[model samples]
Target: MRPMRLLGLKTFRHGVHPPESKDETSGLPIRQFPFAPLLIVPLVQHMGAPSIPVVEEGQEVQRGQRIARPDGFMSVSMHAPASGLVRRVALAPSISGRMVPAVYLEPFPGSTQEIEDGTPCPLEATPEEIIAAIQDAGVVGLGGAAFPTHVKLKIPEGKFVDTLIINGVECEPFLTTDHRVMLEESRDIFTGIRYLLKVTGAENVIIAVEANKADAAEHLRETFPSDLNGSVEVLQVKYPQGAEKMLFSALLGREVPSRGLPLDIHALCCNVATTAQVGQLLPRGRGIQERVITVTGPAVKRKGNYRIPIGTPLRFLLEHVGVADDVNRVFLGGPMMGAAAPSLEISITKGTSGVTAFTDTAAERTHSPVYPCIRCGYCVDACPIFLDPALLGKLAATEQFSTMTDEHHLMDCFECGSCSFVCPSHIPLVQRFRAAKAAVRKSKAGAA
Candidate 1:
């Protein structure tokens, strides 16, 4: 392990320190959320082709039954969150504000919610076999990326991974789902680590946690398996510390090349919650039906972490949790890096990590006046990727999308929001960069 720095904690170079705002719910334990009357299971939850529906309208599906099968290697299967009647298969609102194919289900009121078991993948299974089982289980990066976990485990030909970095750094403020997971599900995490080690062929592992979650770090350390070849490392508290690139850099003192992946540095980083789910589900022969979510904020009356079923409508969630009447805005994740919900009609998906609601009073406070860039270089200092957000913002204002990507390494930003958060001018640098990157992608696709 790399030598510790200031205060005996390892950390990356550039990042902001936003108000954590996690106290309201971080102490709370995870609770199973009541099933919604109508669950809208989006087939396109992960980052790939949408899954194809296997059941038609009016078909009865038991809890954990496969409702949709993966379209291709890039996609993942979907399961019923509860035993219910398939109301319809149609386009439904997703958190992205797009209407995608979804399976609407009316859960049976008094049916036993038993999960269907599939073939269990033992530790001795071949790497290829284990990866296939992961895909079958519909496991994805639970750290809000929603990228298929099975695909990530498949190291490209001719490349090798030496280290597996388990990310427990819940850097995004107000999201304690990971913290709770580490405290409550250490066994599943260790079991998952064994599978991950076999899949990646990593010689050793490192469970990275931030200073803020010392309790979780300690808990994992105490329960850590003696047979495993890794240890837990506490990192300095910093925004975006949970990012794969940042975590690897802090732990191994290695920098992933711009526009590159962890595998480029012979390392693999997986979210702690995602790892635990892999351990919890793979042995049970079950697919992902629900995930833990941190639901909290000023406008929420009963804020806490919830084991929420995938496809639970945001409207229903907020209603059940008791939101204030004057709640002005709600974000699917934390304030930093999370997108604002365009409509409450949009349902939760695999990537939904936290539901943060804000009151009108808080919204008004946050909607501060924007001013011209003062060239203070605060964004430059805050950006974790070492990009000049000041210049990027200037380019974005002039609609120079191509220039931004071609000349400034715009695609490497990852939309961490550190630049926007630290900008005294309130320039919305991250938002502009997101639009610029999208424009660049569209232009490239059109040219192709």
Candidate 2:
């Protein structure tokens, strides 16, 4: 097949251009973070029912041992990140602002991080076997979504996938986990893609990297095996271009419906880090207990990607990295779409991609007053989904969220925060939309 390009630069419509604050750690190689004394592995780390605890409190467990069984098919299991004694099986604070069931493990001083249990599977396994191995490995979308990777490998009866798109577009500022992974784990990525191809029966795969990381793109293209049916596509740099929908547009010019998914267009997109993890774990029959994460921002003393255990607490991690005394805000993901960490007590989960702390000096510009919208169209121009955030913000202010969704395409907004970033008014448009969405979801749940 001939190489496909979306014309010059190749990008989707309407997005913000935040300063790429990645200079600090973009070039730094990944380093391993020492295990904290205790880990808090949340049962509901993925987007499914929380896992049911299989081990009782005070029970000793080995690193990578299964302590919680998946609740159902939609859920994924949880594993111990280190050899330790189960301190408790109780609620813990999550970045989601809710207390979720989590297993607290106090690591043994002499504990080795060696994973001792796994049934190695052959590469030529059947689709069912491959998917089962993936699920047993506990691999999820390491891109921050934390969706179980096994679920994506299963092809529905009628639906056929054509392309497995590996998203290497770390478009968010100050986050270079995917970029570093693409450079360091290219072989694993290819291995994982081949496995995905075998499972889904997809014709080919494409690794999409933004032009900002041209080196990674070049490296992947140069390193991609000649035998495999895959290629590397460099996309135009844009915020949220890393989003699955926007990525589809930039790479294949396919538009997923407002409420639809990439699967609707016969495409599967997984993060580069997630792909590497799958490639590394499935063959060994090992579970996901540790992952590489970017710890950066102005307030962080050591801003680099570190491979950390799944349940390491943010407080301990931040302290090790040496956060500034004046740090006022911390986010679990990227600033644009990441959830604000409610407290430092929250532990890192599968979904965590980065931990960004901002000092008062750095936060001054971001904490500006909420000025009223001046009828400027910057928000509309910046909206990638073409929704009127200005009007949505207005409707949200007056508690007219129902009408906003019914008529103004409120549900279509993915809360990329582009509108808010571009707005001169400093209106918290994204926050308003989030509140409105929460309210709508709550109302629907109540009605149901």
Q: Please write out the lDDT profile of model 2 over residues 39-71, one tens digit for every residue.
A: 998888998778899999999998888888887
By summed lDDT, the worst window of 10 consecutive residues in model 1 runs over 1-10
Backbone clash total, candidate 2: 0
Candidate number achieving the greatest lDDT relative to the actual structure: 1
What are the lDDT scores of the predictions, listed in order?
0.92, 0.88
**TM accuracy, model 2:** 0.97
TM-score of each candidate structure, all chains considered together: 0.98, 0.97
lDDT of 1 by residue, 285-379 (tens): 89999999999999999999999999899999999999998999999989997879999888988898999999989877368989999999999
The candidate scoring highest on TM-score is 1
